[model samples]
Target chain A: AQSVTQPDIHITVSEGASLELRCNYSYGATPYLFWYVQSPGQGLQLLLKYFSGDTLVQGIKGFEAEFKRSQSSFNLRKPSVHWSDAAEYFCAVVVSAGKSTFGDGTTLTVKP
Target chain B: GAGVSQSPRYKVAKRGQDVALRCDPISGHVSLFWYQQALGQGPEFLTYFQNEAQLDKSGLPSDRFFAERPEGSVSTLKIQRTQQEDSAVYLCASSSGLAGGTHTSTDTQYFGPGTRLTVL
Candidate 1:
């Protein structure tokens, strides 16, 4: 069965520090990839997505992701993290139409 | 201008009871989806609808789960005889879309504030 994996369940980073959240997927072909952020008591918001083209994809809120076909990974990154950036980040893959499989999210805590 | 909305932001029902959750997609959206999110886990796909047609329901965990988009605008997910395992946040998402195959940047799913369902 195809699956999405986010190894780190919780990560704590100091404000203004660089951050990276890992994501890996097991699928037959290259699928559409996405990153979403969910704040406490809120629904998810799309941060970025990767359909095709350049491996490096920039998304909203100063976030970017790189899709590595060899590694089967699409890791989310931020040059400088802010306090507001503290939230649960989810990596998802759309293997087929109308189907999106999400990995267990990584909860980031930005410490002052 | 407005995003997707879901009704009854929170629900609590006793085990063996039935419950219905509602989702209102953004206007003009052609695709609707429902997902179940357990604590500390990402949302899992439950079912999907395009317009008024239910295109895929393969993700539904059991027969007790039922979902429908009656008018292509609003949808409902019903659980018969809710179990303790059903205690999770139910999420609804909508995208300006056409059935499938065409994968474009414009067809992005916007999610609504999920409804936290608790089974006692």
Candidate 2:
């Protein structure tokens, strides 16, 4: 079974500061990884994903993630943070059957 | 034209009551999925449907949970005799195709606003 782990429960960053969210996964083979963000009272929105080819994948909202096969990690990163970036972020791993296993989630708070 | 849409944005049901959540996927989407998001937690996979066939349902927590996509376009998730623990936001997402193959899972999954179910 594929499982994801997000080490951070909550992270606070000042506006305009760089941000990085750590994510690790346990899978028997190469895994499909994804990052999603959820705002209050709303469903999750995709931040980025990594499947094959390039190790670095870019997504919406100025976010990006790099897939590291050796580390079994796909961490999300952003050059600068904004207030609107404050939300709950999730790291997920998809199995061959398309079943997605998600981490507990990390809540991001952008401080002014 | 629109993205995924779910009905009854909020549902309140007493314990032991039955509840049904509806999801209308984007037209032409071949894959639909159901997920459960508990308070302060990431969304958990509940099930997946490829067209009218339910290809995977290993994530459903219990037998009380049921889902159907009869026509392959719209899907419904039903919980029988809901328990207090069943209270959570039920989210629906749609993708372009089934898992595996050259198709990348990184493709965006359009999600609905979700149905917040409260089992008191």
Model number 2 iRMSD: 2.0
Candidate 1: tens digits of C-alpha lDDT, residues B1-120: 789999899999999999999999999998999999999899999989989999989989999999998888999999999999999999999988777785522367899999999999
lDDT digits (tens) for residues A1-112 of candidate 1? 6789999999999999999999999988777899999998888999999988999999999999999999999999999999999999999988777578899999999999
Residue-wise C-alpha lDDT for candidate 2, range B40-109, written one tens digit per residue: 8888889988899998898899999999999999999999999999999999999887665646265568
Assess the local accuracy of residue A111 in candidate 2 as a C-alpha lDDT between 0 and 100: 91
Q: List the residue pairs that clash in candidate 1.
A: none
Ten residues in a row with the worst lDDT in model 1 chain A? A92-101
The fnat score for candidate 1 comes to 0.54
Q: After TM-score superposition, what is the CA distance of residue A87 in candidate 2 from its true location, in Å?
A: 0.9
lDDT of 2 at B32: 91
Residue A38, model 1, lDDT: 98
